[model samples]
Target: MPEKEITRISKFLSLVLRHQPEKINITLDENGWTDVATLIQQVNKSGSRLSFEILDFVVANNNKKRFAFNPDKTKIRAHQGHSVEIKLGYPPQTPPAVLYHGTSEKNLASILAEGIQKRNRHQVHLSPDKSTALTVGQRHGKPVILQVDAAAMHAAGLVFYLSENQVWLTGLVHAEFLHVLTT
Candidate 1:
């Protein structure tokens, strides 16, 4: 897939799944899920266009096994509240391993500009060496070290494992990680 396409899908996963809706100050249904129409509207409001079909395609075609269908396929939600949904797909096998979450207190723009720029994976493993990680921690007014179990994610139907790798970076991770690592 094109790099830009990957980046776009990654960002959607982070915003809709990993980040807390309350942080964004949006209310969710009692089921903790949002409707596909509302989700599309939110993306458009955010200056992005993410159709349900795109989400469906991503969830369906992702090689990494990051997304799944809700009980009815009429809606989509993260497998786990803590785990970001990277793509749109239902996997045959559950994922095994743990995922790490990096929280930031910074506003969404800064977080995006610095944290999620050019990532290939669905989730990210955070470290102190990265400025985005530190910024996320600083913004939150606290240090963040998140350890998430992929198998648990799989069981909850939030995250599907792509490979056997134990750790993953959020697909929505800031592009700076790529820029910094590439440089």
Candidate 2:
């Protein structure tokens, strides 16, 4: 498939798989997985041409590795960033001493005042390093990276999980645990 087609399909998949499987009348399993064949059928039924090969291409070529296939290639799901309720089932693990979150400078004040909230998503997403966080921030404009004190939070009885794409997940990061990272 062409690059534009790939991106279009990727975005569509993200929309359906992560937020609204009901849009295509498909259902995700308890752990957020859905049948791959059923997904292709529904996607095509919705007037988007999709095939297992194209799906594989999008999964393999997406820069963030947004989706994954089960070991048997029979199931698939977004790694995280779900709006509708579905458990990802990633086990809790100790994060690095620090993790990074990037956002527009415009949002910094609110973030610093309230810490980071999950908002519409399931969990606050954190990056393992500044560069990735920066890229994420740039999307929102006037990028600003915030350093999170993961160690302190963990010590304070908070839990963290690393998604398949290496994005960090946490229920919350209180304002006290954040520091504006100066580049």
Candidate 3:
């Protein structure tokens, strides 16, 4: 398929798998997984053509590795960024000494005072590197990157999870553990 087509399908999959499966008449399980066949059928029935082969291609070629298939390939789910309530089932893991969060410059003041909150998403997403965080921040507006003291947070009893896509997940980063890296 063409790149544009793949992007379209990928975004649609992100929408359904991460946020609104009901829009396509499909439902994800408590762990955010859905039957692959059911997803293909429901998406096609909803007027967007989708097939196993196309789905496979999209899953394999997505740049961010946003989606993942179960071990048996019978189920699929987004790696993270779920707005709907669903347990991701990621085990608590030790993160690196530092992690990065990207956001728009406009939000810096509030973030400085309140720290990073998950808001609508399941967890506050963090990047292992500043470049990735900068790219993520650019999506919102003028990018701002924040350094997170992951080791300190972990030592303080906060837990972290690494999603399949390599995005770090945590409940929140208090202002004490956050430092503005770039504005």
Candidate 4:
């Protein structure tokens, strides 16, 4: 795909699935999912009309498995962030400590690699307590937390911890840790 087209799709996915839609001033649904009609309207309002074909093509070609057509294929939802449904897709033997998310913005299958090991997008080294975890999730959109192997994250050098009232950092785990703890 052309670089511009790729960037457009990336932005589309970001706004649709990621909570960072505010970065572009596009407000998504409370659940962060917007129907196809609504999305088309948004596009039209932007002085760009995205046809159904283009929308389907973009959704199909998106790397992240963030967007999904509803069961009836009528509405679409960005299945990003926290999901109440328990994805027992992982093996029962696996311990809970680190959760994996697809950083891909192209293929959704890459986001779900059953059985095989995976990596996290931002290895958030949060306090190992529920209250703290919930507190850390505050101010930001509520994030889903699947049990992950904390030991693996620590071993792979992808763990970052935030102080009691701070949780803003974007870099390698070490830099993020310093920034969060120091600030």
Candidate 5:
């Protein structure tokens, strides 16, 4: 398929898999896994054409590695970023000394005072590197990157989970553990 088509399908998949599966009349299991056949059927039935071949291509070629298939290729799920209530079942992992979070410059003041909160999503999304954080921030507005003291947070009894896509996950980062890296 063409790149544009792939991108469109990928976004739609993210929407369904991460945020609104009901829109397509499919349901993700407790661990967020959904039957691949059901997903394709539901997607097509929803008036957005999807085939196994296209789904496979999208899963394989997604730039961020946002989705994954089961060992037998019969099931699929988003790696993370679920807005709906679903247990991702990621085990707590040791993160690096520091992680990064990207956001709009406009939010810096409030963030400096209030710390990073998960808001609507399951957890505060973090990046393993500044570049990735910058990209994430740019999506909102003028990018701002914040350095997180992950080691310190972990030492303080906070837990972290690294998603399959390599995005870090944590409950929240208090202002004490955050350092403004770029405005």
Candidate 6:
């Protein structure tokens, strides 16, 4: 596949699967899976061409590993980062001792005062490593990394989930659990 085609389809898939299934006239089940056949047909109807082969390629090759297929490959769902209301139903897990969050420096003041909020996303995303967090932050501009004391947060009873893609998911990270990671 041409790089352009793959990139286009990957982005479109991310958009629909994570944020707007309605854009393609499909709805995800409560657990976020959508029938693969139906999703492909819907994509075609929406003026985009999709096939199981292409879908498989995107799921396997996406840098973030953002989508997943069911065991039989009959269904699919975004690994996380859903803004649309849907229960991913990922079971809670104990997070690592530390996690990292990346954001633009412009948001530092609010984050320092109030802590990180999910904003429009369903949950605040944390990376297991600083390098991944840095990449995420760079998207927003002058990257700022926040080191999260995950062990402390877990001890304090904050729940955490590990997405299939390995991102950490939590409702919030209070300022007390956060430290600005200085280079």
127 in model 1: Cα distance from truth in Å?
19
| lDDT (Cα, tens digit) per residue for candidate 6, span 61-99 | 888888899999999999888898888888999999999
Preferred candidate (lDDT higher): 1 or 6: 6
lDDT of each: 0.48, 0.94, 0.95, 0.42, 0.93, 0.92
Cα-based RMSD of the predictions, in order?
Answer: 12.1, 1.0, 1.1, 14.5, 1.1, 1.2
lDDT of 4 at 87: 22
Q: Per-residue CA lDDT of candidate 1, range 1-183, in tens?
A: 565786578556646654655433444454445666666666667677677777777766654434556667666555432433334232444433543445543434455456532243344443323444544456466544333444444555443333222223333443322222211
In model 6, the clashing pairs are none
Off by over 4 Å in 6: none
Better-scoring candidate (lDDT), 3 or 6: 3
lDDT of 3 by residue, 1-183 (tens): 798998999999999999999998999899999999999999989998888999999999997899999999999999999999999999999999999999999999999999999999999999999999999999999999999999999999999999988999999999999988845
Ten contiguous residues minimizing lDDT sum, candidate 1: 174-183
lDDT tens digits, residues 47-76, model 2?
988899989989999988999999999999
- Model 6, residue 180: displacement in angstroms? 1.2
Of the pair 1 and 2, which is ahead by lDDT? 2
lDDT of 2 at 57: 89
How many angstroms is residue 143 displaced in model 6 relative to the true structure, after the best TM-score fit?
0.3
Collision count for each candidate, in order: 27, 0, 0, 11, 0, 0
Residue-by-residue lDDT tens digits, candidate 4, 88-147: 121212223543221222222332333212234322333344444444344345433233
How accurate locally is residue 100 in candidate 1, as Cα lDDT from 0 to 100? 41
Clash pairs of candidate 2?
none
